[model samples]
Target chain A: MPLTKRIIPCLDVKDGKVVKGTAFVNLRDMGDPVALAARYAAQGADELLFLDITATIQERKIFLSLIKSVARQVNIPFTVGGGISSEADAYNLLSAGADKISVNSAAVKEPALVSKLAKRFGSQCVVLAADAGMQADGNWQVYVNGGRKNTGISVLCWIEQAVQMGAGEILLTSINNDGGRKGFALSLLQEVTARVQVPVIASGGAGSLQHFADVFEQTGADAALAAGIFHEESITIPQVKQYLYKQKIPVRL
Target chain B: MKLVIVDYSAGNTCSVIFALNRLGIAPVISADAAEIRAADKVILPGVGAAGSAMLSLQQNGLDNVLRSLQQPMLGICLGMQLLCTASDEDDASCLDILGGQVQKLDAPKIPHIGWNDVYDLRGDLFKGLPENSYLYFVHSYGVPVSRATIATAAYGQSFSAAVQKDNFYGVQFHPEKSGDNGLLILKNFLNL
Candidate 1:
C-alpha cells in the first residue's frame, strides 16, 4: 500500500507557552504546550513539530521539561527544532522525548552537523528544516535565523546537500507564504520534493483545508504543516483530515 | 500479563512504553535475558542500522537469548528485520527464528517513512484491524513475503508487512505510533 499524506500541526514555543508568529515576525501567545499537544494528538494529528522560537539556556531547560511531560501525554512521533546546532543538543532533545531533531541555520553553517547527528543517532532521527523565500528570479533562496538572514544559497542545492549528508526528512517552510494565510508555495514544494528522496513536509501559508488539498495535489510533498490555523482553532486537525479524505486523499480517519 | 520490551540499545522504545501505559500495562524495558525469558510476553523493539543492532544484541548476549524465547514475542521495524535470517543492510546476519531474508527496498525512496496500509491480514496480531488499515512504517530494508508471512504491504514492491511462525511474530510497521489502528494491534498482541 502507498504511504498516506500526513497532516502536521506545528507549535512555536516561546518562554514556555506555545506561540504563533507572522512570517517569523510578531509573535503571539497560544496556550500551554502540553495541554495543546494532548489536544492535537487526540484530534488525530499525524505528527507534531515543536519549534523553540526562543532557545535561551533558561528556556531550553523549560522546553525539555515540557517535552518530557508532553511525551507522556502524547503517543505519536514529534520533531523538535530551533538551536539544535550540536550533537549534544540533539542528544539532549532526543533523550528528553523528541523523536526527531530538525536542523536549520546551524546545518547551513556546518553541513557536517547533519551527518554527525545522523551517524550518532540513525538518519531517521534527523530532520532538515529549510526556510525559503521566492526571489525575483523565480528561484527560492534559503534564509536563516528565523528568516532574518538570507544565506543566498539555492533551496534545491541546500536540500540536496542536507539529504546527502543524511537528513531523513525535509521541513520546507516558505517564508513569503508563512503566516500569510494565502496558500503554500506549490512551485517551491514541488521543486524540493522532486529533488529529494526524503519525505518533504510543506509548511507556511495554510489558510484553509482547500489550501492543504491544493498543496498535496499540486506538489509531491509527503505532508503539510500549519501553526496559526491549528493553534487558533480556526481549523481542527480532524476537519482538515476529513476534508482530505473527501478529496480522495488517503488520510487516516 | 507480564510484559517485557527487549531493549538492546534500540532507539525509541518510549512510544511503545507509552502505548502500553495507556492500556494500563507498565512494561519493563530490559536487555536482561532472565527477565525476558521469565516474562509472559516480550516485545523486541529496535531502530537503527541492522549491523549495529545485531552487534549490540550479540555484545549484550541477548541474541541467543532472544532466539530461545518460548513465550509469544513480537518484533517491530528493525526488531522485525532482526528476526529474519539476514538483512542486506550492512549484510548483517540476524536471528533466524522466521524463514526468509530481509532485503533493502527497491523503492524510489530509501527509508519508507510514514503511514501505509497493510492488507491480507492472517494472524491474531492483527485481530479487529480492518484489511487495508493504515499503520506507520520507517525503515530502509524489509523481508520478502514467505511461508511465515501473514500480511503484505506494497511500497515500490510487495514486502512482508507482518509475519508469524509458531509463537514468533514480527511487523514491519510501528504499531506504537500508528494511532488507533496501532493501539488495536498491540491490544490484540497483548491478548494473545
Candidate 2:
C-alpha cells in the first residue's frame, strides 16, 4: 500500500476572526481562530489552513498572533494564507509556526514570485491558491480578493503555469461551489486535476462526508478542503473518514 | 517520564503534545538540546514545505540534535518526509535521516481527503486499529513506499502510510486527529 494525501478544513480569518459566507461575505465571527483550530484538531481535522483574508490589501500582518497561539495549542499541520503578497509575509507565517504559506492573488499577479520563493525557500514552502469562478464561456477563470477580482486567466492554465513556476501545491477553491455545500463542481475539479501535476486541494461545496468521498474518489485530487461544515460541526473529520473507509477509499487511520 | 516533542518552528508540535495528554501520556514540548537529550522519547511533528522546514531545523541547530538522538523518535507527516533523503515537494533535500525520496502524489483527484483505510499494518501501532482503520491525512506529497513502510493505503495509487526503521518511526497521517483508532495508534507509539 502507498501513502494517501490529506483532508483539510480551512478557516478564513478577517481582522482577527474566523468568518465564512457565500462568495466570501456575510462575515460573522465564529470563534477565536486558535480555539476553533484546536477544536477541529480534536475532532480529527487532518490539518488546518488559516487565511488572513484582509491582510494583503491593508498590508497588515496576516494574523500572526492567531497563528502563534494556534501553533502553541494544536498538534496538526497548519497552512496560513490571505494577504500573503511577499516572501517576508511567508517568512513571518513560518516564524509564527505555519507549516506552509498559501498564495493566490499574489501568484496570479506575479507568476515569477512563486518561483522566486520556491527557489529561495523551496516549492513545498509556497502553495498557490486559486479562487476559481466559472466564466460565462465555460472556462474556470481565476478570481482574487475574496472572489471580487477576475484575473482573466483560465484556472487550469494558471495551475499548470504555477507548477511550472515551482509552486509545490495548489489550493483550488471554487467560488461557484464555495459555501454552497452542494458538493464540489466535479467538472471543474476533474479538469484541474487532469492538467496539474502537483497536489490539488479541492475547496468549496462540501456538505457531507460523502461529499468528500465523492470528490476524492471521483476527481483524484490530493486532498479535499472544507470550512463551513467542519467549523459548525455539521460533520466531523473522523465521521467523514470512517465513511470513506467504508467506501474503501484509502484514508490513513 | 513525559513524552518530549521537539519544537523547531514546525507547527504541529503542540497538537501532538495535546494528543499525547489525551491518550493519558503527558508530553513536554521542547526545542532545547538538553531537554531532548534527557527525554524518554521524542516525536517530531511538522507541516509545510520541506526545504524551509529543514532550514528552521538547521537554524536552531536541531538538525544535528535530532540525528544524534538514541531515544525512540516518531516523525509525523512532513516530519516523516524530512527524515527521508529527498522529497519532490520543493525538490527538498531532506534530513536524509531515512532512505528513499518523498514523491509527489500526482493523481486525477488530489488532496485525497476523507478517512481512508491503511493496510499491511506491521507493528503495535495497529493493535486496536481495525483492519483498514481510518487515520487523518493532509499532505500534498509523500515518501515513496519503501522497505520502511509498515502499512499502506490507496487513493489514486497506494503509497507509504506508516514507516519504521530502527529507532525512527513515522506516519504520514495525523494520529492525533484520527479519533479512537488514531489514538490507539498513538498509544502504541507511546508504548514503543
Candidate 3:
C-alpha cells in the first residue's frame, strides 16, 4: 500500500545493441536493446535505464532512434544517459520519448547545465548520474568521461550541489563496485540519500538478490540498478522482486 | 472511436501516442480546439511544472476549450493537477474543473518517483484491474483525496490516484508508461 522500492535493470547499449562488461570495460554483446527492454518490462522491472556506453555525436542519431523504438514497444518509464551535454540534447531525447535524461560528465563540466535542464524541462526530467570511486583516504572522488577521468571533487559535495541545482533524481554509481558485482556501495548511498531530498537510485555492484534487499533495507535508496547479472540470466527481475518482497521490502510484483 | 491526445507541449505525448498505438488506436495529437472537440474522447497528458503548463494552456486558449468540453477528457500527471482549482507548486490557479487543491507531497522524497499501488478503485477507469494494482508514478504535487476521487494511492499520505466528475477524469499517474495495467486504464477511458 506504500511506495515500493524499485528494481531497475540497466542496459549498457553500444552501436544500438546491448553490451555488458566489467567495470565499464571488456564489452560483449548481450542482445538487442529494444528486445531486452521489452523482456525486462514483462518481467515486472520497476524501471529500465539505457546508458549509451559509447555515446558519441555521430551515435546521437542512433541513440535517438533506439529510444523511439523502445518507447514504441516498452510500456514502463525509462531513463537514458550518456553524451547529453546541452539543453537541446536533453530535449531531443525527451521528445523521442525518454522519460528522463541523465547527465554525468556533462554536469561535471558545467554545473549550471543541471539547473538549465531542470528549469527548462522541470527537475523530474533531469537525473544526475554521479559516478565515483572510493579513494585510499575513504572519501569518494567523482569520476567523469565514462569513469575514465577523475574530477578530484568529493562525491558527497557534488551530489548535494547538483540537487540544489534542481536535479530531481540521483543515480549514484560506484565505479569500483560497477561490473564487479560484489555489492552496492551501501555507505555512499546511505550518505547521499540522507543528504538529498530527491529520490536516490543506487547503481553498480548488484550481484545477488540480497544485494537488492540490502541497499533498500540498509539505506534510503529508492531503486537499485543492475546490468550484467540480468543480462546473463543469472538473476531475473521477478526473482529479485520476489526476494525483496519476502525480505519485507515493498516491491511491485 | 476518434480520440485526440491534447498536445500542450508539457507532457510525454509520444509515450501516450505509442500506448494507444499498441491498443490499435492511433490517436491524433493536437493542440487545435476544433480537432480536440471533434474527437469522441480527449486525453490531456502533462508533465513538468504547473505554472508554465497552465500558461501554455491559457496562451493557446486550451484552458477554455478543456473547461468547456462536453465529451470525456482524461488528464494525466500534471494534466490532472491542472484540472484542480489551484496548485501549491507555483501558487498557480488551475482550470478548476475538479474541486480541490494540488499540494506538494509530504513525503521524505520530493518528487515521489517510481511505482506504487492504487487502492480503493472505483468507476470504470480501473475496470478489470485488480485492487491495489501497481502503477508507475513520478510526481511531487497531488490532489488530496476528495469526493470526486475514484481511486487512491499513498506516498507519505493518501492522495487522489484517479478522480472523475461527470465527463472530466484525471489520473495522477502516467498510465501510458504504466505497462499493462496502465494500458488497460487507457482502454477503459477509451470505452467510456
Candidate 4:
C-alpha cells in the first residue's frame, strides 16, 4: 500500500502561545499551545510542528515549558524548532517530549550541528527546516534566522547537503508563498523532493484544500503544513482530510 | 496490573509513558531487572541505532532480562527491531527472541517517517483496530516476516508490522506516537 499523504498543522509559538503572521510579520496571538495541540490531535491532524518564535534566552525557558505541556496533551508526533543551536538544546526538547527537533539558522551557521544531533539522537529525530524564497535568477535561496537573512546558499544545494549530513526529514517552507495563502511553491517543492529521497513537508501558502491536493499531486512531498488557516480555523483539519480522501489521496480520517 | 516501560536511554519514553497514563495505566520506566520481570505487562520502547541500544541494555543487564521475560512484552519501533536475532544497523546482534534478521528497508525513503496502513493483522495486539488502519512509523531498518509474524506492511517490500512468539509481542510502528488507532492498539496490549 502507498504511504498516506500527511496533513500537518504548524503552530508558530511566541511567548508560550500560538501565533500567526503574514509574510512573517505582525504576529498575532492565537491561543494556548497545549489546548490548540490537543484539539488538533483530536481533529485527526497527522502531525504538529511547533516553531518557537521566541528569540531570547530567558523566553526560551517559557518555550520549553510550553513544549512540555503541549506534548503531554497530545499523542501524535510533534516537532520543535527555532533557535536550537546545539545538541544540548535538542536533547532538552526531546526529553521534554518533542518527537523531532527542527533546526534552521543554527544548521545554516554550522552544518555540523545537524550531523551531531542526528548522530547522537538518530537521524529520524533531526529535521532540517529550510525557508526558501524566489530569487531573480529563477532559483530559490535559503533564508536563515527565521527568514530575516539570506545566506545566498542555493536551496537545492543546501537540501542535498543537509540530507547527506543525516537530516531525516526536510520541512521546506517557501518564503515567498508564506502567509500569501495563494498556494504552495509546487515547483520548488517538486525540485527538492526530486533531489532528496527523505520525506519533505511543504509549508507556506495553503489557502484552500485544493492547495494541499496540488502539493501532493504535483510534488512528491510526504506532507503539507500550514499555520494561519489552521490557527484561524478557516478550515478544520477533518474537513481537509475528508477532502483529501474524496480526492483519492489516501488520508487517515 | 503493573506495567513497566524498559528505558535503556533509547529516547522518547515520555510520550509512551504519557500515552499509557492517559489510558489509566501508570507505567514505570526503568532498566531494573526485577521491575521489568515482575510487571504484569512490559513495554520495550526504543528510538535510535540498534547497536547502541543493545549495548545500553547489556550495560544495564536488561538484555538477559528481556530474553527471559515470561510476561507479555511489547516492543515499539527500534525496540521491535532489537527483538530480532540481528540487524544490519551497525552490524548489531540483538536479543534473538524472534528468529529473523533486521535489514535496511529498500524503499524510496530511508526512514519511512509517516503514517502507513497495516494489513493482514492476525493477533490480539491489534484486537480492535480495523484492517488497513493507519499507524505511524519511523525507522530505517526492520525485521523480515517469519513464523512469528502477525501483521505485515509494505514500503518497498513486505516486512513484519507486528510479530509474536509466546508472550513476546513487538510492533514496528509507534503506537504511542500514532493517533487514536494507536491508542487503541496500546489499550489492547494493556488488556492482553
Better of 1 and 3 by DockQ: 3
Q: Per model, how much of the real contact set is kept?
A: 0.57, 0.20, 0.82, 0.74
Which has the higher TM-score value, candidate number 1 or candidate number 2?
1
Off by over 4 Å in 4: none
* Candidate 3: fraction of native contacts reproduced: 0.82
Local error of candidate 4 at residue B101 (angstroms): 0.5
How do the residues A53-124 of candidate 4 rate in per-residue lDDT, one tens digit apiece? Answer: 877988899998888887778999999999999998999999999999999999999999989999999999
DockQ metric, candidate 3: 0.83
Candidate 1 lDDT at A18 equals 89
Clashing pairs in 1: A1-B154
The better candidate by lDDT, 2 or 4, is 4
| Model 1 Cα lDDT, one tens digit per residue, B1-192 | 799998887777777888899888999988888999999999998878889999999999999999998899999989998998888888899998886779988888767878888999997888888899988888878899888898899899999999998989999988887778889989999999
Clashing residue pair totals per candidate (backbone < 3 A): 1, 33, 0, 0
Q: lDDT per model, in order?
A: 0.89, 0.78, 0.92, 0.91
Interface RMSD of each: 1.5, 5.5, 1.0, 0.9
Q: How close is candidate 4 to the true structure, as a TM-score?
A: 0.98
Q: How does residue A62 of candidate 1 score in lDDT?
A: 91
> Fraction of true contacts reproduced, model 1?
0.57
Clashing pairs for model 3 are: none
Question: Which pairs of residues collide in model 4?
Answer: none
At residue A228, what lDDT does model 3 achieve? 93
List the RMSD of every prediction in angstroms.
1.5, 5.0, 1.0, 1.0
